[model samples]
Target: MNKQTETLPDQWDAPARFLHWVSAIWVLGLMGLGLAMVNLVKASGLKFDLYQLHKSYGFLFGLVLIVRLTWKFIFHRRKISNRGFLHQAAIINHNLMLLLLLTLIASGYVVTCFSIIPIPIHVFGWNVPSLLSPDMLMEQGAISVHHMIAFALLALVLVHIGAALFHHFILKDKTLIRMLK
Candidate 1:
Protein backbone atom coordinates (compact mmCIF):
# COMPACT_ATOMS: atom_id res chain seq x y z
CA MET A 1 0.00 0.00 0.00
CA ASN A 2 1.10 3.56 -0.64
CA LYS A 3 2.26 5.80 2.23
CA GLN A 4 -0.77 8.04 1.79
CA THR A 5 -3.03 5.07 2.47
CA GLU A 6 -1.00 3.85 5.41
CA THR A 7 -2.27 5.11 8.74
CA LEU A 8 0.08 6.23 11.42
CA PRO A 9 -0.31 4.68 14.84
CA ASP A 10 -1.11 7.77 16.92
CA GLN A 11 -0.55 10.71 14.59
CA TRP A 12 -2.99 12.39 12.27
CA ASP A 13 -2.04 13.11 8.69
CA ALA A 14 0.25 16.13 8.33
CA PRO A 15 -2.33 18.38 6.74
CA ALA A 16 -5.01 17.53 9.28
CA ARG A 17 -2.59 17.91 12.17
CA PHE A 18 -1.24 21.22 10.90
CA LEU A 19 -4.67 22.65 10.27
CA HIS A 20 -5.90 21.49 13.68
CA TRP A 21 -3.16 23.26 15.65
CA VAL A 22 -3.10 26.31 13.42
CA SER A 23 -6.85 26.71 13.71
CA ALA A 24 -6.64 26.33 17.48
CA ILE A 25 -4.03 29.08 17.64
CA TRP A 26 -6.14 31.27 15.40
CA VAL A 27 -9.18 30.80 17.63
CA LEU A 28 -7.21 31.68 20.75
CA GLY A 29 -5.91 34.82 19.08
CA LEU A 30 -9.40 35.77 18.02
CA MET A 31 -10.72 35.22 21.55
CA GLY A 32 -8.08 37.56 22.92
CA LEU A 33 -8.87 40.10 20.22
CA GLY A 34 -12.59 39.84 20.91
CA LEU A 35 -12.12 40.44 24.64
CA ALA A 36 -9.86 43.41 24.00
CA MET A 37 -12.30 44.90 21.52
CA VAL A 38 -15.19 44.52 23.94
CA ASN A 39 -13.30 46.28 26.70
CA LEU A 40 -12.11 48.99 24.37
CA VAL A 41 -15.60 49.62 23.12
CA LYS A 42 -16.88 49.96 26.68
CA ALA A 43 -14.10 52.29 27.78
CA SER A 44 -14.88 55.13 25.45
CA GLY A 45 -12.84 58.35 24.92
CA LEU A 46 -9.73 56.44 23.91
CA LYS A 47 -8.19 57.68 20.63
CA PHE A 48 -6.97 54.21 19.72
CA ASP A 49 -8.26 52.79 16.42
CA LEU A 50 -9.81 49.82 18.14
CA TYR A 51 -12.72 49.35 15.81
CA GLN A 52 -10.55 49.36 12.70
CA LEU A 53 -8.17 46.85 14.19
CA HIS A 54 -11.00 44.66 15.35
CA LYS A 55 -12.65 44.69 11.93
CA SER A 56 -9.39 43.89 10.18
CA TYR A 57 -8.70 40.98 12.50
CA GLY A 58 -12.22 39.72 12.08
CA PHE A 59 -11.82 39.71 8.30
CA LEU A 60 -8.58 37.79 8.55
CA PHE A 61 -10.15 35.26 10.89
CA GLY A 62 -13.14 34.78 8.61
CA LEU A 63 -10.85 34.13 5.66
CA VAL A 64 -8.83 31.59 7.62
CA LEU A 65 -11.93 29.77 8.80
CA ILE A 66 -13.20 29.53 5.25
CA VAL A 67 -9.93 28.13 4.00
CA ARG A 68 -9.75 25.67 6.90
CA LEU A 69 -13.25 24.46 6.21
CA THR A 70 -12.48 23.98 2.55
CA TRP A 71 -9.32 22.08 3.34
CA LYS A 72 -11.10 19.88 5.87
CA PHE A 73 -13.78 18.87 3.42
CA ILE A 74 -11.53 18.45 0.40
CA PHE A 75 -8.71 16.43 1.92
CA HIS A 76 -8.93 12.75 2.73
CA ARG A 77 -7.64 11.74 6.13
CA ARG A 78 -7.55 8.73 8.40
CA LYS A 79 -10.68 8.29 10.43
CA ILE A 80 -10.31 7.32 14.07
CA SER A 81 -12.62 4.71 15.54
CA ASN A 82 -15.85 6.03 17.03
CA ARG A 83 -17.03 2.89 18.76
CA GLY A 84 -17.09 4.47 22.22
CA PHE A 85 -19.24 7.18 23.77
CA LEU A 86 -16.24 9.44 24.31
CA HIS A 87 -15.24 9.22 20.65
CA GLN A 88 -18.77 9.89 19.50
CA ALA A 89 -19.05 12.85 21.82
CA ALA A 90 -15.78 14.23 20.56
CA ILE A 91 -16.91 13.93 16.98
CA ILE A 92 -20.16 15.67 17.78
CA ASN A 93 -18.41 18.44 19.65
CA HIS A 94 -15.94 18.99 16.83
CA ASN A 95 -18.69 19.20 14.24
CA LEU A 96 -20.61 21.60 16.44
CA MET A 97 -17.54 23.77 16.77
CA LEU A 98 -17.18 23.98 12.99
CA LEU A 99 -20.79 25.06 12.70
CA LEU A 100 -20.40 27.62 15.46
CA LEU A 101 -17.30 29.06 13.90
CA LEU A 102 -19.01 29.49 10.56
CA THR A 103 -22.00 31.17 12.20
CA LEU A 104 -19.79 33.50 14.22
CA ILE A 105 -17.86 34.56 11.14
CA ALA A 106 -20.98 35.20 9.10
CA SER A 107 -22.70 37.21 11.83
CA GLY A 108 -19.55 39.16 12.60
CA TYR A 109 -19.08 40.11 8.96
CA VAL A 110 -22.70 41.18 8.68
CA VAL A 111 -22.36 43.35 11.78
CA THR A 112 -19.23 45.02 10.46
CA CYS A 113 -20.65 45.52 6.99
CA PHE A 114 -23.57 47.44 8.47
CA SER A 115 -21.34 49.86 10.32
CA ILE A 116 -21.83 53.55 9.47
CA ILE A 117 -18.14 53.98 8.84
CA PRO A 118 -17.31 54.58 5.17
CA ILE A 119 -13.94 52.85 5.20
CA PRO A 120 -13.26 50.93 2.01
CA ILE A 121 -12.41 47.30 2.74
CA HIS A 122 -13.02 44.90 -0.09
CA VAL A 123 -12.92 41.12 0.12
CA PHE A 124 -11.86 39.40 -3.12
CA GLY A 125 -12.08 42.78 -4.82
CA TRP A 126 -15.85 42.80 -4.27
CA ASN A 127 -17.54 45.29 -1.98
CA VAL A 128 -19.70 43.69 0.67
CA PRO A 129 -23.09 45.34 1.11
CA SER A 130 -23.93 46.76 4.48
CA LEU A 131 -26.90 45.04 6.00
CA LEU A 132 -27.96 48.42 7.35
CA SER A 133 -28.24 51.73 5.58
CA PRO A 134 -31.13 53.98 6.64
CA ASP A 135 -32.66 50.98 8.42
CA MET A 136 -31.49 51.13 12.03
CA LEU A 137 -33.83 48.35 13.15
CA MET A 138 -32.16 45.67 11.06
CA GLU A 139 -28.75 46.80 12.22
CA GLN A 140 -29.79 46.53 15.83
CA GLY A 141 -31.28 43.11 15.31
CA ALA A 142 -28.20 41.77 13.55
CA ILE A 143 -25.93 43.18 16.24
CA SER A 144 -27.99 41.48 18.94
CA VAL A 145 -27.85 38.16 17.16
CA HIS A 146 -24.15 38.56 16.51
CA HIS A 147 -23.45 39.22 20.16
CA MET A 148 -25.58 36.28 21.25
CA ILE A 149 -23.85 33.92 18.82
CA ALA A 150 -20.44 35.13 19.93
CA PHE A 151 -21.25 34.32 23.54
CA ALA A 152 -22.56 30.90 22.58
CA LEU A 153 -19.42 30.14 20.61
CA LEU A 154 -17.31 31.22 23.55
CA ALA A 155 -19.17 28.84 25.85
CA LEU A 156 -18.81 25.99 23.38
CA VAL A 157 -15.07 26.60 23.06
CA LEU A 158 -14.64 26.49 26.82
CA VAL A 159 -16.48 23.21 27.01
CA HIS A 160 -14.46 21.75 24.12
CA ILE A 161 -11.07 22.63 25.61
CA GLY A 162 -12.11 21.45 29.04
CA ALA A 163 -13.30 18.13 27.67
CA ALA A 164 -10.08 17.62 25.71
CA LEU A 165 -8.05 18.25 28.84
CA PHE A 166 -10.20 15.90 30.84
CA HIS A 167 -9.67 13.17 28.30
CA HIS A 168 -5.94 13.77 28.12
CA PHE A 169 -5.08 14.05 31.80
CA ILE A 170 -7.89 12.32 33.65
CA LEU A 171 -9.03 9.61 31.28
CA LYS A 172 -5.51 9.02 29.99
CA ASP A 173 -6.85 8.42 26.53
CA LYS A 174 -5.35 9.07 23.14
CA THR A 175 -8.29 11.23 22.20
CA LEU A 176 -6.40 14.51 22.41
CA ILE A 177 -2.98 13.20 21.42
CA ARG A 178 -4.16 11.49 18.27
CA MET A 179 -4.47 14.85 16.60
CA LEU A 180 -0.94 15.82 17.55
CA LYS A 181 1.86 15.32 15.09
Candidate 2:
Protein backbone atom coordinates (compact mmCIF):
# COMPACT_ATOMS: atom_id res chain seq x y z
CA MET A 1 0.00 0.00 0.00
CA ASN A 2 1.10 3.57 -0.60
CA LYS A 3 1.90 5.75 2.42
CA GLN A 4 -1.34 7.72 2.12
CA THR A 5 -3.46 4.58 2.13
CA GLU A 6 -1.29 2.35 4.33
CA THR A 7 -3.33 0.68 7.02
CA LEU A 8 -1.71 0.53 10.41
CA PRO A 9 -4.18 -1.19 12.75
CA ASP A 10 -7.90 -1.68 13.31
CA GLN A 11 -8.10 0.63 16.32
CA TRP A 12 -7.02 4.10 17.25
CA ASP A 13 -4.49 4.61 20.02
CA ALA A 14 -6.00 4.98 23.50
CA PRO A 15 -4.72 8.53 23.96
CA ALA A 16 -6.16 9.70 20.63
CA ARG A 17 -9.54 8.20 21.44
CA PHE A 18 -9.48 9.77 24.86
CA LEU A 19 -8.68 13.15 23.36
CA HIS A 20 -11.41 12.74 20.79
CA TRP A 21 -14.02 12.12 23.47
CA VAL A 22 -12.71 15.01 25.52
CA SER A 23 -13.09 17.37 22.60
CA ALA A 24 -16.63 16.16 22.02
CA ILE A 25 -17.66 16.76 25.61
CA TRP A 26 -16.04 20.15 25.79
CA VAL A 27 -17.56 21.29 22.51
CA LEU A 28 -21.07 20.23 23.47
CA GLY A 29 -20.86 21.66 26.95
CA LEU A 30 -19.57 25.00 25.76
CA MET A 31 -22.26 25.24 23.09
CA GLY A 32 -25.04 24.49 25.52
CA LEU A 33 -23.69 26.94 28.07
CA GLY A 34 -23.36 29.62 25.42
CA LEU A 35 -26.91 29.18 24.21
CA ALA A 36 -28.29 29.21 27.75
CA MET A 37 -26.33 32.29 28.67
CA VAL A 38 -27.67 34.22 25.71
CA ASN A 39 -31.25 33.00 25.67
CA LEU A 40 -32.13 31.97 29.22
CA VAL A 41 -30.26 34.17 31.58
CA LYS A 42 -31.76 37.55 32.52
CA ALA A 43 -29.58 38.67 35.38
CA SER A 44 -26.52 40.56 34.24
CA GLY A 45 -24.44 39.09 37.03
CA LEU A 46 -25.45 35.58 36.08
CA LYS A 47 -24.82 36.24 32.40
CA PHE A 48 -21.41 37.69 33.14
CA ASP A 49 -20.54 34.71 35.33
CA LEU A 50 -21.58 32.30 32.60
CA TYR A 51 -19.58 34.16 29.99
CA GLN A 52 -16.51 34.02 32.19
CA LEU A 53 -16.98 30.34 32.80
CA HIS A 54 -17.44 29.73 29.09
CA LYS A 55 -14.36 31.71 28.17
CA SER A 56 -12.22 30.00 30.78
CA TYR A 57 -13.28 26.54 29.77
CA GLY A 58 -12.89 27.45 26.10
CA PHE A 59 -9.33 28.63 26.72
CA LEU A 60 -8.59 25.33 28.41
CA PHE A 61 -10.24 23.42 25.59
CA GLY A 62 -7.93 25.15 23.12
CA LEU A 63 -4.96 23.86 25.08
CA VAL A 64 -6.40 20.34 25.02
CA LEU A 65 -6.80 20.60 21.23
CA ILE A 66 -3.20 21.73 20.93
CA VAL A 67 -2.05 18.72 22.90
CA ARG A 68 -4.24 16.42 20.83
CA LEU A 69 -2.85 17.78 17.59
CA THR A 70 0.69 17.49 18.92
CA TRP A 71 0.07 13.92 19.96
CA LYS A 72 -1.37 13.17 16.50
CA PHE A 73 1.79 14.54 14.90
CA ILE A 74 4.01 12.52 17.23
CA PHE A 75 2.14 9.24 16.75
CA HIS A 76 0.72 7.24 13.90
CA ARG A 77 -3.04 6.93 14.24
CA ARG A 78 -4.79 3.86 12.91
CA LYS A 79 -6.26 4.51 9.49
CA ILE A 80 -9.71 3.58 8.35
CA SER A 81 -9.78 1.01 5.55
CA ASN A 82 -9.36 2.46 2.09
CA ARG A 83 -12.91 2.33 0.74
CA GLY A 84 -12.38 4.71 -2.19
CA PHE A 85 -14.95 7.51 -2.20
CA LEU A 86 -16.16 6.83 1.33
CA HIS A 87 -12.59 6.82 2.56
CA GLN A 88 -11.85 10.14 0.87
CA ALA A 89 -15.05 11.63 2.25
CA ALA A 90 -14.15 10.53 5.76
CA ILE A 91 -10.70 12.05 5.44
CA ILE A 92 -12.12 15.34 4.17
CA ASN A 93 -14.71 15.48 6.92
CA HIS A 94 -12.16 14.79 9.64
CA ASN A 95 -9.74 17.41 8.31
CA LEU A 96 -12.49 19.97 7.92
CA MET A 97 -13.61 19.36 11.49
CA LEU A 98 -10.11 20.07 12.71
CA LEU A 99 -9.85 23.23 10.64
CA LEU A 100 -13.24 24.50 11.87
CA LEU A 101 -12.28 23.87 15.48
CA LEU A 102 -9.01 25.75 15.13
CA THR A 103 -10.79 28.63 13.42
CA LEU A 104 -13.37 28.71 16.21
CA ILE A 105 -10.63 29.00 18.79
CA ALA A 106 -8.89 31.82 16.96
CA SER A 107 -12.13 33.71 16.41
CA GLY A 108 -13.08 33.29 20.07
CA TYR A 109 -9.74 34.75 21.08
CA VAL A 110 -10.25 37.65 18.71
CA VAL A 111 -13.67 38.32 20.18
CA THR A 112 -12.27 38.63 23.67
CA CYS A 113 -9.32 40.69 22.54
CA PHE A 114 -11.41 43.32 20.78
CA SER A 115 -14.34 43.50 23.17
CA ILE A 116 -15.49 47.01 24.04
CA ILE A 117 -15.11 46.05 27.65
CA PRO A 118 -12.14 44.28 29.09
CA ILE A 119 -12.81 40.56 29.15
CA PRO A 120 -10.51 38.62 31.38
CA ILE A 121 -9.67 35.16 30.13
CA HIS A 122 -8.59 32.72 32.79
CA VAL A 123 -7.66 29.08 32.46
CA PHE A 124 -7.87 27.05 35.64
CA GLY A 125 -7.33 30.21 37.72
CA TRP A 126 -4.38 31.69 35.79
CA ASN A 127 -5.30 34.96 34.12
CA VAL A 128 -4.61 35.48 30.43
CA PRO A 129 -4.48 39.07 29.25
CA SER A 130 -5.96 40.19 25.97
CA LEU A 131 -3.62 40.27 23.01
CA LEU A 132 -5.34 43.10 21.15
CA SER A 133 -6.59 46.54 22.09
CA PRO A 134 -10.30 47.10 22.47
CA ASP A 135 -12.22 47.75 19.27
CA MET A 136 -15.99 47.41 19.25
CA LEU A 137 -16.19 47.01 15.48
CA MET A 138 -13.62 44.22 15.39
CA GLU A 139 -15.20 42.56 18.40
CA GLN A 140 -18.63 42.58 16.76
CA GLY A 141 -17.21 41.09 13.57
CA ALA A 142 -15.44 38.37 15.48
CA ILE A 143 -18.59 37.60 17.45
CA SER A 144 -20.54 37.04 14.24
CA VAL A 145 -17.80 34.81 12.83
CA HIS A 146 -17.60 32.89 16.08
CA HIS A 147 -21.34 32.21 16.11
CA MET A 148 -21.32 31.12 12.46
CA ILE A 149 -18.43 28.74 13.01
CA ALA A 150 -20.11 27.32 16.11
CA PHE A 151 -23.23 26.37 14.17
CA ALA A 152 -21.14 24.86 11.42
CA LEU A 153 -19.19 22.85 13.95
CA LEU A 154 -22.37 21.64 15.56
CA ALA A 155 -23.72 20.45 12.22
CA LEU A 156 -20.42 18.76 11.37
CA VAL A 157 -20.37 17.01 14.73
CA LEU A 158 -23.85 15.66 14.19
CA VAL A 159 -22.82 14.39 10.77
CA HIS A 160 -19.79 12.71 12.27
CA ILE A 161 -21.94 10.98 14.85
CA GLY A 162 -24.40 9.90 12.20
CA ALA A 163 -21.64 8.51 10.01
CA ALA A 164 -20.26 6.57 12.94
CA LEU A 165 -23.66 5.07 13.68
CA PHE A 166 -24.18 4.19 10.03
CA HIS A 167 -20.87 2.36 9.95
CA HIS A 168 -21.73 0.47 13.11
CA PHE A 169 -25.26 -0.48 12.11
CA ILE A 170 -25.32 -0.72 8.34
CA LEU A 171 -21.83 -1.43 7.05
CA LYS A 172 -21.15 -3.99 9.75
CA ASP A 173 -17.57 -2.87 9.59
CA LYS A 174 -15.09 -2.27 12.40
CA THR A 175 -15.00 1.44 11.70
CA LEU A 176 -16.97 2.52 14.74
CA ILE A 177 -15.61 -0.33 16.83
CA ARG A 178 -12.07 0.79 16.16
CA MET A 179 -12.71 4.25 17.57
CA LEU A 180 -14.50 2.81 20.57
CA LYS A 181 -11.56 0.64 21.37
Candidate 3:
Protein backbone atom coordinates (compact mmCIF):
# COMPACT_ATOMS: atom_id res chain seq x y z
CA MET A 1 0.00 0.00 0.00
CA ASN A 2 1.27 3.47 -0.95
CA LYS A 3 0.73 6.44 1.43
CA GLN A 4 -0.25 9.78 -0.15
CA THR A 5 0.69 13.25 1.17
CA GLU A 6 -2.26 15.38 2.23
CA THR A 7 -2.46 18.88 0.78
CA LEU A 8 -3.47 21.97 2.72
CA PRO A 9 -6.50 23.96 1.62
CA ASP A 10 -6.06 27.34 -0.13
CA GLN A 11 -9.31 28.94 1.08
CA TRP A 12 -11.20 29.50 4.27
CA ASP A 13 -14.30 27.62 5.41
CA ALA A 14 -17.64 28.50 3.81
CA PRO A 15 -19.09 30.48 6.73
CA ALA A 16 -15.98 32.65 7.08
CA ARG A 17 -15.96 33.42 3.37
CA PHE A 18 -19.65 34.31 3.40
CA LEU A 19 -19.24 36.69 6.34
CA HIS A 20 -16.22 38.36 4.75
CA TRP A 21 -17.93 39.04 1.45
CA VAL A 22 -21.14 40.24 3.10
CA SER A 23 -19.29 42.54 5.49
CA ALA A 24 -17.16 43.94 2.66
CA ILE A 25 -20.18 44.64 0.48
CA TRP A 26 -22.12 46.20 3.36
CA VAL A 27 -19.25 48.48 4.38
CA LEU A 28 -18.44 49.59 0.83
CA GLY A 29 -22.01 50.30 -0.16
CA LEU A 30 -22.85 52.15 3.08
CA MET A 31 -19.68 54.21 2.88
CA GLY A 32 -20.46 55.21 -0.69
CA LEU A 33 -23.98 56.22 0.29
CA GLY A 34 -22.64 58.23 3.23
CA LEU A 35 -20.14 60.03 1.02
CA ALA A 36 -22.87 60.96 -1.39
CA MET A 37 -25.05 62.22 1.45
CA VAL A 38 -22.28 64.49 2.70
CA ASN A 39 -20.85 65.73 -0.61
CA LEU A 40 -23.51 65.62 -3.29
CA VAL A 41 -26.84 66.28 -1.61
CA LYS A 42 -27.80 69.90 -0.95
CA ALA A 43 -30.07 69.73 2.10
CA SER A 44 -33.08 68.52 0.17
CA GLY A 45 -35.68 65.77 0.42
CA LEU A 46 -33.19 63.41 -1.23
CA LYS A 47 -30.68 64.13 1.49
CA PHE A 48 -33.27 63.33 4.17
CA ASP A 49 -34.20 60.14 2.38
CA LEU A 50 -30.55 59.15 2.07
CA TYR A 51 -30.04 59.73 5.78
CA GLN A 52 -32.97 57.45 6.60
CA LEU A 53 -31.65 54.78 4.29
CA HIS A 54 -28.20 55.02 5.84
CA LYS A 55 -29.65 54.69 9.35
CA SER A 56 -31.78 51.72 8.37
CA TYR A 57 -28.78 49.95 6.87
CA GLY A 58 -26.67 50.81 9.86
CA PHE A 59 -29.22 49.13 12.09
CA LEU A 60 -29.15 46.08 9.84
CA PHE A 61 -25.35 46.07 9.86
CA GLY A 62 -25.38 46.16 13.63
CA LEU A 63 -27.45 42.97 13.62
CA VAL A 64 -25.01 41.33 11.22
CA LEU A 65 -22.16 42.33 13.53
CA ILE A 66 -23.82 40.56 16.43
CA VAL A 67 -24.29 37.36 14.42
CA ARG A 68 -20.77 37.53 13.01
CA LEU A 69 -19.29 38.02 16.47
CA THR A 70 -21.32 35.07 17.77
CA TRP A 71 -20.17 32.92 14.84
CA LYS A 72 -16.56 33.92 15.50
CA PHE A 73 -16.71 32.70 19.06
CA ILE A 74 -19.02 29.70 18.71
CA PHE A 75 -18.12 28.28 15.29
CA HIS A 76 -15.07 29.70 13.48
CA ARG A 77 -12.31 31.04 15.67
CA ARG A 78 -9.23 32.68 14.08
CA LYS A 79 -10.54 34.16 10.82
CA ILE A 80 -7.98 33.07 8.23
CA SER A 81 -4.42 31.76 8.16
CA ASN A 82 -2.48 31.19 11.36
CA ARG A 83 0.91 31.85 9.85
CA GLY A 84 3.59 34.19 11.31
CA PHE A 85 3.56 37.98 10.64
CA LEU A 86 0.50 37.81 8.42
CA HIS A 87 -1.57 36.13 11.08
CA GLN A 88 -0.40 38.52 13.79
CA ALA A 89 -1.22 41.54 11.67
CA ALA A 90 -4.53 40.04 10.63
CA ILE A 91 -5.52 39.46 14.24
CA ILE A 92 -4.66 43.02 15.19
CA ASN A 93 -6.50 44.43 12.19
CA HIS A 94 -9.57 42.29 12.76
CA ASN A 95 -9.81 43.24 16.42
CA LEU A 96 -9.31 46.92 15.69
CA MET A 97 -11.85 46.89 12.88
CA LEU A 98 -14.43 45.29 15.13
CA LEU A 99 -13.81 47.85 17.87
CA LEU A 100 -14.07 50.79 15.49
CA LEU A 101 -17.28 49.46 14.00
CA LEU A 102 -18.83 49.03 17.42
CA THR A 103 -17.84 52.55 18.34
CA LEU A 104 -19.30 53.78 15.06
CA ILE A 105 -22.55 52.04 15.81
CA ALA A 106 -22.76 53.34 19.36
CA SER A 107 -21.89 56.87 18.37
CA GLY A 108 -24.43 56.72 15.57
CA TYR A 109 -26.98 55.54 18.08
CA VAL A 110 -26.18 58.50 20.29
CA VAL A 111 -26.52 60.91 17.40
CA THR A 112 -29.90 59.51 16.46
CA CYS A 113 -31.14 59.25 19.99
CA PHE A 114 -30.28 62.83 20.82
CA SER A 115 -31.09 64.46 17.52
CA ILE A 116 -32.29 68.09 17.52
CA ILE A 117 -35.36 66.89 15.72
CA PRO A 118 -35.73 63.21 16.46
CA ILE A 119 -35.45 60.86 13.46
CA PRO A 120 -36.23 57.49 14.95
CA ILE A 121 -36.05 54.20 13.06
CA HIS A 122 -39.23 52.18 12.64
CA VAL A 123 -39.29 48.44 11.90
CA PHE A 124 -42.61 47.01 10.77
CA GLY A 125 -44.83 49.16 13.00
CA TRP A 126 -42.85 49.37 16.24
CA ASN A 127 -40.47 52.28 16.76
CA VAL A 128 -36.89 51.82 17.90
CA PRO A 129 -36.89 53.80 21.12
CA SER A 130 -34.16 56.30 21.83
CA LEU A 131 -32.46 55.30 25.03
CA LEU A 132 -31.17 58.78 25.63
CA SER A 133 -33.25 61.90 25.68
CA PRO A 134 -32.62 64.77 23.25
CA ASP A 135 -29.51 66.83 23.90
CA MET A 136 -27.80 69.07 21.33
CA LEU A 137 -24.46 69.08 23.11
CA MET A 138 -24.22 65.32 23.34
CA GLU A 139 -25.56 64.87 19.84
CA GLN A 140 -22.89 67.21 18.47
CA GLY A 141 -20.17 65.37 20.34
CA ALA A 142 -21.39 62.00 19.13
CA ILE A 143 -21.58 63.32 15.57
CA SER A 144 -17.96 64.42 15.73
CA VAL A 145 -16.86 61.09 17.15
CA HIS A 146 -18.91 59.21 14.55
CA HIS A 147 -17.31 61.24 11.75
CA MET A 148 -13.81 60.57 13.10
CA ILE A 149 -14.49 56.86 13.45
CA ALA A 150 -15.97 56.77 9.98
CA PHE A 151 -12.78 58.26 8.55
CA ALA A 152 -10.65 55.85 10.58
CA LEU A 153 -12.71 52.88 9.43
CA LEU A 154 -12.34 54.06 5.83
CA ALA A 155 -8.55 54.15 6.23
CA LEU A 156 -8.50 50.71 7.82
CA VAL A 157 -10.69 49.34 5.04
CA LEU A 158 -8.20 50.64 2.48
CA VAL A 159 -5.41 48.89 4.36
CA HIS A 160 -7.45 45.69 4.49
CA ILE A 161 -7.94 45.79 0.73
CA GLY A 162 -4.27 46.64 0.19
CA ALA A 163 -3.21 43.71 2.34
CA ALA A 164 -5.41 41.38 0.32
CA LEU A 165 -3.93 42.70 -2.92
CA PHE A 166 -0.43 42.34 -1.55
CA HIS A 167 -1.15 38.76 -0.60
CA HIS A 168 -2.62 37.89 -3.98
CA PHE A 169 -0.23 39.84 -6.25
CA ILE A 170 3.00 40.39 -4.38
CA LEU A 171 3.27 37.75 -1.66
CA LYS A 172 1.47 35.20 -3.88
CA ASP A 173 -0.22 33.69 -0.84
CA LYS A 174 -3.57 32.08 -0.15
CA THR A 175 -4.62 34.93 2.14
CA LEU A 176 -6.82 36.65 -0.43
CA ILE A 177 -8.30 33.42 -1.73
CA ARG A 178 -9.28 32.48 1.82
CA MET A 179 -12.22 34.84 1.58
CA LEU A 180 -13.35 34.23 -1.97
CA LYS A 181 -16.30 32.03 -2.94
Give all candidates' CA lDDT scores. Answer: 0.70, 0.87, 0.82
For residues 27-142, write the lDDT of model 2, one tens digit per residue.
Answer: 99999998999889999999999999999888889999899888886675554457687778878888888899999988988999998887679786677888899999989999
TM-score of each: 0.77, 0.92, 0.89
Per-residue alpha-carbon lDDT of candidate 3 for residues 51-166, written as tens digits (9 for 90 to 100): 88888888788888888888887886433334577767867888889899888878887889999797897555656789999999989999899989999999888888899999
Where is model 3 poorest over a 10-residue stretch in terms of lDDT? 1-10
Higher-TM-score candidate of 1 and 2? 2
Instruction: Give the residue spans of candidate 2 off by over 4 A.
Output: 1-5, 77-81
**What clash count goes with each model?**
0, 0, 0
By lDDT, the better pick of 2 and 3 is: 2
In angstroms, give how far residue 73 of model 2 lies from its true place.
2.3
Q: Model 2: how far is 157 from its true place, Å?
A: 0.6
Q: Write the per-residue lDDT of candidate 1 for residues 1-181, one digit (tens) a residue.
A: 2224433367666777787888788777776777677764665544245655555666777788777777877765455444577667767877888898888778777766665656534555665566545335655777788778777877878888899799789989776798864
RMSD of each: 4.6, 1.9, 4.9
